[model samples]
Target: MALLETRDLTKEFGGLRALDRVNIAVERGELVSLIGPNGSGKSTLINTITGMLEPTAGDITYAGTDLVGMKPFEIAQLGVGRSFQTASIFPELTVSENVEVAAFAAEHDSFSVNFFRRRDAYDEVRERTDHILETIELDAKAEETAEALPYGDKRRLEVAIGLATGPDLMFMDEPTAGMSPGETEMTVSLIRELLEDWGMTIFLVEHDMDVIFDVSDRIFTLHEGQVIARGPPEEIRDDPAVREAYLGGEEA
Candidate 1:
């Protein structure tokens, strides 16, 4: 079975449909990308699958278990994790603290019970946090405040926070947004490490055509709340429907 599967998933807001009977799957150890123009339901699909929004209809399964009705934390506990389009880090906190918090949340179900404890009290959480920082090349700045870092580093910190959750499948939403060329290259390398070295399965939504084409094993193109095309990168780049809908009828 696929690691994650959505069968005919649909979501609507009043009279309008945000997602219309969408079907997609991600196998283990693959980097699958979802591409679409703004308002094409890319965010909606991620929110629905990750339990941030309830689906209006259809089935979502992760590791063969129904995901509908599960809370966001409930889904996280099942080994799913995500990073946002914008950098979603706690600016005031030190970089290490941010990662420790995520690792702590993943290890303990009840925050009320352990929330007041000293962060150092949890040896495993600290170790995992340290490991993630090293892996993401943020250990050198571990003690710096998140707000003090450069924009690209802030985004990398967000990815590290997601990694601290120990996910088998990760959903990354535009991890390279607002980055310089050099920063984007760094993030791409990190993503490649996550897939190749750590053996992670990723579902990504991104606007950067270069990054998408370079990293994705398969690409799904959405137009007007439905998938218009899906194929390998070369095929997606040349697809007539994708060209018309997303690429301005020009080559990507």
Candidate 2:
């Protein structure tokens, strides 16, 4: 069975539909990309799948079970982790501390309430945090405040925090947004390492064609709130329909 699947999922804002009859299936250990122009409902679909936005129609399934009516954290507790387009790290906290918070969540402990309890027992969280930092190549900035780190590093910290959730499926809204050429290349490499070496399944939405083509095992294109085409990189590249929607002229 597919690890994550959505069937005819939709969310409507008044009469305007954000998503309409979208069906997507992500296999375990696959890096799938959702690609489309702005207002194509990529973010809206992500929010609906994560339960942050209520769907007006349809259902989502993870691990062969229905995900309808589940709360956001409830979905997380069920092993779905996600990062938003905006960096979601704690600006005031150090990078290590930011990941530690997510580690506590994975272990089902309260970082907020247990902030001061068992200070000596935090070696595990610290170690795990360090591992994630190293994997993302942010170990040198572990002590730096999240707000002080570079934008790309901040996004890496966001990914680290998402990893700390210990999820079977992760959704990254845009892993390469606002990055320099070098940083974008580095971020793509990091994603490949994380999925190929560390064994995390990722469903990420991105506008960067390079990142999408480099990372995605499968690509799904959205237009007017529906999936218009989906296939491997080669097929998608050759698909005239996809090109029409993505690169074709709409101007008169």
Candidate 3:
């Protein structure tokens, strides 16, 4: 079975349909990219699958378990993790503390009294946080406040936070947005490491054509809330429908 599957999934905001009978499947260990122009329902798909927005119809399954009706935290506990298009981090908290909090949530499922304990109290959480920080190359700035870091580092910190959740499948929503060329390169490398070195499956929503073409094992193109094309990178690059819908008949 695929690691994540959605069938006839639909989401409606009143009369406006953001997603329409969308169906997609992600296999284990595959880096799949979802691409399209703005308002193509890319983020809506991610949000619905991750349980931030309940689906209006159809079914969602992760690891063969029904995901519909589950809360976001419940889904995360089932080994699904995500990073937002915008950096989601605690600006006032130190970098290490941000990851540690995610790790702690993964372990305990709820922020109870255990959250008040000393940071070092949980050996496993501390170890996992340290490992993620090192993996994302943020260990050197572990003690710095999250808001004090550069924009690139802030984005990396979001990735580290997601990693601390110990996910088998991760949803990365434009992890490289608003980054300089050098920063984009660094984030791309980190993504490669997550898939190749850590052996994790990723479902990515990205706009950087270069990054999508370079990293994706398969690409799905959406337009007007429906998938218009899906194929390997080379095929997606040359797909006529994709060019019309995503690039306005211009070459991709």
Candidate 4:
């Protein structure tokens, strides 16, 4: 069954149509990659689906619920999560504390009770935070400051923060953006583990064809704000239009 579906999705910024009548679907437990050159609407489609940008026309449905008018937080609460292209976290906070804070805020969004709430009140969040740290292989660094970790570990911490949300489906924008080859390999393995071990579906926006081709079950190609091609990895690798547009006429 389709875990997420978008029908005739369109988004406009004034006179610019960033996404033009695009339709895509992700089945549960599949790792789907969305690839396109810059300005081809990859990020625009992710933003629209994740509620950062409202679509001008069309429908977005997740787990059978329409997400057309939902807020980002609401979508997150509904088991959708995202990690930005850049690593986002508090440098001053400890690694465990970073996930703990996100977990606590996710559980209680209201700020009115902050003054009376006790640290002991967040027992559940604390437990989950530890589990997330372990899952992301950062448990050994739990007491270290976020900024003190190596660059690759910091990236993993950001993934930990997203995992703390307990999402069934995740949108990752360039998860291996600035990693070294070894780090990239580790991250790739981590993403695969999310599918095999955690039973999560992923919709990834990435520039690295090696990473995309290595991990994605299916690939979607976007060009000039429209979905140009989509199919299995081998089919996408052999697509002529994909070569002319994004691949620069080179074979994958």
Candidate 5:
């Protein structure tokens, strides 16, 4: 079975449909990229699959379980987690503390509300936090405030925080957004390392054509709320419709 599958999944708002009859399947251990121009429903699909929004119609199956009505936290507990296009870390917290916060919630029972208790009591959280920091090469900055890190490191920290949740499937929404060429390249290398070393599955939405082309095992292109193309990197690169809509556009 596919690790994550969406069969005719769709969403609508009033008279307009944000996603239309989308059918996508991501295999276990695969690295897939979703690409589209603005308003093409890439983020909408993520929101629907993650329960940030309810879909108008269709099925979402993760690990062969139906996910149509599950809550975001419930989905997280099922070993699926996601990060955003922007750095979504806590600026005031130390880098380690930010990761610990998410790790704590994921490791403990879902109803943990004891804020007065010391966080160190949660050994799993602390251990996972430390492990994720090392994975992202941020252990040296574990004690530093999140806001104090350079821009590139801050972005990586946000992803590390997501990693602390210990998800088998991770969705990264444009992890390389707004970075210099060098920074983008480094982040791409880090993602490849994550796949090679950690055995993690990935779903990504990206705008940098070069990065998506280089890093993706498969690429799906969306246009006007529907899938225009999907294939291996080489096939996607050669697809005429995708080329016309994105790579062959006058601006491109």
Candidate 6:
């Protein structure tokens, strides 16, 4: 079975249908990219799948469980994690502390103050936090405040926070947005490494065609809140609808 599957999923904002009976399936260990023009519902699909927005109709099946009505925390607990277009991290906290906060939330049974009464009692959470920092190559800056890191590192720290949730599947919304060419390249490399070395599945939404084509196992092109096409990168690049609508008929 597909690792994640959606069947005729629909989400409406008043009379506007943000998602129109969208159906998608992601296999385990696949790096799938979502692309489209603005307002094409790429982010809407991600938000709906991740429980940030409730679907108006249809089924979301992940690992054989229906996810349509689940809460955001419930989805995270089911081994799904998400990183936003804007980096989300604690600016005042040290890099390590940022990841530690996510780790504590993911590992603990409750959010009560009593959970923090004994730091030593949560050795596993601490170890996982450190491991996530190392995995994302932020160990050297573990003690630095999040706001002090460069922009690229700040983005990476957001990924680390997502990693702290121990997800098998991760949704990254425009991870390379507003980055320099060099920074974008490095982030692309890091994403490839995450898939290859960390054995995680990724569903990515990115405007950078180079990064998406270079890294995606398959690409889904959306138009007006529905998938217009889905295929390998080569096929997608040549698809008439995709080329005309989003790629602007430019040769890749």
Clash totals for all candidate models: 0, 0, 0, 0, 0, 0
lDDT of 4 by residue, 29-70 (tens): 999999988888898898999899999999999999999999
lDDT on C-alpha atoms for all candidate structures: 0.89, 0.85, 0.90, 0.87, 0.85, 0.88
Task: Please write out the lDDT profile of model 2 over residues 1-252, one tens digit for every residue.
Answer: 999999999889999998999999999999999987778899999999998898999989999778889888888888899864434678999989988977886665434555447666478778888888898999999998889988888887888888887777889988888999998988888888879888989998988887888779999998879898999988887888777877663520
List candidate 2 stretches off by more than 4 Å. 85-87, 109-121, 248-252
On the 0 to 100 scale, the lDDT of residue 184 in model 5 is: 88
Misplaced by over 4 Å in model 3 are: 85-87, 110-121, 249-252
Model 6 TM-score on a 0 to 1 scale = 0.92
Candidate 2 vs candidate 6, lDDT winner: 6
Pairs with backbone N, CA or C atoms under 3 Å apart (clashes), candidate 3: none
TM-score of 4: 0.91
For every model shown, what is its TM-score relative to the native structure? 0.93, 0.91, 0.93, 0.91, 0.91, 0.92
User: How does residue 135 of candidate 6 score in lDDT?
Assistant: 71
Per-residue lDDT of model 6, residues 1-252, tens digit only: 999999999999999998999989999999999999988899999999999999999999999999988898899999999874334687999999998888888767444566668767478777888887777788999999999999988998888888988899999999998889988887898888889988999999999998998999999998878888999999999999997776563333
Which candidate would rank higher by lDDT, 2 or 3?
3
User: Which tens-of-lDDT digit does each residue in 114-147 have in candidate 3?
Assistant: 7557575588788888889988999999999998
**Model 1 scores what on Cα lDDT?**
0.89
> Considering summed lDDT, which 10 consecutive residues are worst modelled in model 2?
107-116
